[model samples]
Target: MDIRFIPQAEIDKQLYNSCVHFATNGSLYGYDWYLNATAKEWDLLVEGDNYVSAMPLPRTTNWIGRTQLTQPVLVPDLAVYSVKPLSPKRIQAFWDAVPEEYRGGGLTVEPASVPKNAGRFEVTTAVGDALFLNKSYEEITDDFPSTYYEQLARAERADLLPVPALKPEAYADFWLSVHGKSVDNEWKYHAMQRLMYQVLHRSWGNAAGIQTRDGQLLAVSFNVYSHNRIFPLFRAESKAGGDAGAMTLLNDTLLRSHANRSLKIASEALYQRSR
Candidate 1:
């Protein structure tokens, strides 16, 4: 049960590999490329000699000089990633392993991973639900309500074609135009949008979109690919797109198209939830 801490500044291939192997969603968000690209340093928790179990500690400081730990974007909640669910006692040990300095700090944890008898840490409801794609296209299409079905049908008739090879700038620019005013006017938000587009150029994922027959862009999404899962990051649609049901068509098409492959699309709550 030996535990070692690796500062975010010193993370390397070895540590990143360990993270990818041990973390549940490692393949998507636990790689050096992702960590470096995001430019947000995250400390690592390694167990035993080779990182048998681990978790990331994403760190940041506020303008008021108060340092806080927060979850990175486009990632599900962090977990004490391990070979199996940690027992109540081990979960407590994991919590204790956090540098005493961070013990009192707030961090996000997967609700399921937090043992019932663990610590007295506060747990808040997650802001969003993630859609884990497991069902087939036929299954998905059949289940969607009439509203979605009607949207898809109209979007197609509107002559808005799917742009599977959508460009990154197109997606970023569109989002900024529509939603940037609502967010912090900081450079970081803008920079992250650029970085997301840059990453889209890689084989890891793609920038998907939909456009009218006249080539007017209506919607775009940057889907990050890793470990056979596709997370469509920042999917957005224009007024025209919304009216035409461009998103409904795009998403439904993806689900059906990738049904043969082992690929699954994880969304931030596209369907209903029980928890």
Candidate 2:
């Protein structure tokens, strides 16, 4: 139950890598190769002989002399990554091990591994979506709302075909055109999102794209995979793609292609609006 906050440089990379490498709930977000690009500093948590968890804390200072730790963009949930699925007691123990200052700034972790009723900190939840391959691809297709099918068919008719992969920069350009150009906030996170592309480019994942007949990019899909799960980290579509459901068709195409892998898409964010 003892936790030590060893600085990233001082931490043993081999042991830490092994911790996440063998973690039951591991994702690319927990890996150094991926996290290092976005986070400057992180602390490893150790329980006796084992490196149990790692926390990447990206801190910033304001002109008003206020400094605070914030979760880096492209990293959704990276609190304490444990080797085992976090139980209530383990989650509490892990937090108790974390220093109080580090605790207050709020951290996010995967919904599946989250600790319920954490002590004294106000908690919030965001609903997400995933698709599992327990059923045949055809059966899974049946589960898609009639609208998904309708839009997908329309996209196909318009010749928005799914290709196995696309360039990260191409995807970013399209993403910015759709989200950043249209939104008032201007999606300041696009920089971080693009950095994620470089990180993931070296990792075990695949990118898919939907394009017009002349090869104009419509939508891009970047999904990272663990042993048996796929995390649909980010997917974006242009207005034309959105109008024709290019993204939906792309996702379905991905599922159908990978259906033989017995993979489950563990998404906390569902693709479509729920009625």
Candidate 3:
């Protein structure tokens, strides 16, 4: 068996086409888009003749964070791999080949059975989502106290915060500091950043940072966009003070702006773990 690394962008159309054909008839979620989005950060492993596999490598440093709640490990799309049916031994061997540094991180494996002309092909898909927030804004805000709205109104009247906008480059150091807090894992940082980028680029999402009256960053929140539905992916507050209420205020303001629409708020899984 020989293992070859191919840039994700260079993968032949036939391979993707094949995957799509199988995906259409398979139970996999987001299969078609997954196959199409495979990029240079992904790899394909081939055995003697019939078996094939696709693996995704860590492509960014957003997953790592000092605080468990702040980490980006749960964003559903980090490192993943898709493979045609192979024996347990081959599967184990394939994982064994991964560099030790990358092997022990947030790697996940999912297996699917796809029927091929020759016979049956087992497709193993692996990825990780440390936290997934897909609920509407109302669902998200339900967790906070009712007084939160009053505080948000105050903040807005005082002009004490910046509007949440997509500021990818502005938060570089903030992201790095969060990543540095991790004890052993570094791959998480990449996942975190990817999640942030995905949210920022989506027309349905917006991100903003909150600062204290003294101009210190108090928290950051990613608000989902929708006419009648809203979701909050990541919402965090600085550890320097007991201003947890600030986050609640941020959410209140967001909800008020979209009060005309039905809203659901969701948070990363890590948020619950941290609390």
Candidate 4:
């Protein structure tokens, strides 16, 4: 088999369609979102009689490649590999085909390694009702003030809630407030940029914004959509208010509003601590 690298945009649509079909029918979780996010950055690896494609999905400076072999092969143990509802045999076969060189590197194929599922939690409304099924927090705390939830719930009930949205222009200001106090890194900015583009392209759900009572743009969140799942890509708030809790408030409102749709909160493992 010859390994050939090509841009994702150049890959045959039929092959992509096949991957999608396999993902959906074969119980691949996050595959749809991964494919859609990295569709334009994929490289196809072909053999004499068969072909496969590798697509890279980047978050900040880190990236993970999703390999699609022509035949069902052993899946790699990448941090993002999620094949639910798929037969154990098929999943094992997929993992078996993963290149040995790719096996134990920092690269991950398992869903847990992606850092997306981190900080995911099921947060309830102040009324102690299960408002959101799964939620991700920026930090994990053993004793987060319970009052925060109550305040958030109150905010929602009063219709003073924040909506999850992505505003690219506010990226710099938001990051400075969130991470700058501790360490100044540009990774968040890059991630935000990619997220903004994804939002602009509607790669995620409809993006929206949160405002202060004074009408200040406080934060933005990316609402990622995949059939029934809705993941918030990036959620941040201004630092002007001490313990603003705008993000928490926004999440509460979103969950309450989206309860009828059964929207599941999804994220990489890195954000799971807060959940």
Candidate 5:
């Protein structure tokens, strides 16, 4: 029950990372490498000597030059992951461990680890769809609308193909080319590219895309494989690709390949909630 804030330099990475690696509610977002790529600076909040419960506190200096605790870009929310479902008191203790200056920052707890009551915490629930890949491909596809099949057929007719493990640089450039206007700042643009390279080069995740017969890129996604789940970091589809159903085809191909694996694809709703 002893909870303390450990600065980044002071953290015992071996113990802290092991806790995050094995936590039932873990995700790539909690990993040190991930925080290193996205956070301006960060530290840990650990529950005990064994590091049974933990959270990563990411910090940043705002545009006005004020330091603030914040979540990383492209990350929807974070959690106080633990060995077991923590009681409200334990959860509160973790919150109480936050340095007073960082108190106002918010974090979202994993659905599995959240308690029924949160003492003194303003708890709110955000729900999103997840594609559960427990069933056979056919069984899962049976629930899809007829239009999905039609899109797949269109993609097929257009000779668009799903290509796994897309090259990082190519995909990043394409992503920025297609969506750069939407990204308002140079920092965010660089952060997105840095995250893509880190996730792909480190083998923590992969980039998949759809391409034409001539290998022209059309649609792409960066999927982080962690916590026994697939979370998309960035996804985009060109108009030509969308019209040809390249994105739909790419998604179906991914689902089919992983069908019956008991994995979940974190939905677009989940990934884009913070955006």
Candidate 6:
């Protein structure tokens, strides 16, 4: 139950990263490189010398210019990650150890992490979706309606082909040019750009897209992969391409590329939207 905060610089990256990578519920977002790219600043709360349990406290400047522990963009869960399953009380200890200044700020925990006890902190719930890639692509799609294949066929007829390796910089520029104005907040846009670059630069993941044979770019998506999971993080599509079912084709390629790998797609909403 002994938990203490370690400043970002003072923590042992090797030990901490080892714990996260090997933990039962480890995620790419919990890794050091991920935090460096997304969080403006961060610290850690550790439960034991071997890092038996740990939580990442990502910090950022709020709209009002005050420092707060905030969730990074596109990051879903940021709670205690432990080598073994944690009891509600042990999880609560890590939450309590978070510095008071970051109290009002929020982050998310995996559903399995919460077990009916939250001593003094307020808790809110949100729903997310994931797709399990446990079977062959055909078997996985067998449950889908025939219209889904029709959509992909339309994209193929339109001459849209999958670009399995899209340059990160190109994807970022494409995303910003398309969705930047809609963001309304400049900081969020820049933060997203930084995250995309760092993640791709480190080769932690890759960006893929659908484009015409004549080389007209249409739809693009960024996916981060670990040993057993893939996170379909950000995506943008041109109006014409979307109408031609470019997104559907892009997602189909993604599914086919990693089919039968037993990987999990963190956000299945992307696939659902394409349909």
My TM-score estimates for the predictions, one after another, are 0.81, 0.82, 0.43, 0.55, 0.86, 0.86
Tens digits of lDDT, candidate 2, 99-187? 55554455566654455655544334434656677777787777566777788778878977776466666666666776666442244
For model 5, residues 1-275, the per-residue Cα lDDT tens digits are 78888999988888887888898767777777667767758888998888898978787766766655675776676678788666777766776677866644454545644545544444444357877889899987776777888888888899887774567667767777777556354455667678877776767778889999888889988888877788877688888888898888878878788999978876432322111
Predictions: Cα RMSD each: 3.7, 3.4, 10.4, 10.2, 3.5, 2.8
Which segments of model 4 are wrong by more than 4 Å?
A: 1-10, 25-85, 100-103, 106-148, 153-166, 181-187, 239-242, 267-275
Candidate 4, overall lDDT? 0.41
Clashing pairs in 5: none
Better structure of 2 and 5 per lDDT:
5
Where is model 3 poorest over a 10-residue stretch in terms of lDDT? 113-122
Residue range 185-241, candidate 1, lDDT tens digits: 344346556567556556666777888888877877777766567767666788888
Flag regions of model 2 displaced more than 4 Å.
Answer: 55-58, 62-67, 111-122, 181-203, 269-275
What's model 1's lDDT at 249?
A: 71
- Deviation of model 4 at 152, angstroms: 2.2
Better of 3 and 5 by TM-score: 5
| Per-residue lDDT of 212 in model 5 | 92
lDDT, candidate 4, 31-142, per-residue tens: 4334443332323332222223222332211246533322111112222122233344433333333443232323334332233221221111111111234334322222
Winner by TM-score:
6
| lDDT, model 6, position 56 | 86
lDDT of each candidate versus the true structure: 0.63, 0.64, 0.42, 0.41, 0.73, 0.74
- What pairs collide in candidate 2? 77-108, 128-268, 128-269, 128-270, 129-268, 129-269, 129-270
* Native-to-model Cα distance after best TM-score fit, residue 52 in candidate 4, in Å: 11
How many steric clashes does model 2 contain? 7
Query: Which is the leading candidate under lDDT?
Result: 6
Error of 5 at 81 (Å): 1.5
- Candidate 4 residue 216 Cα shift, in angstroms, is 3.1
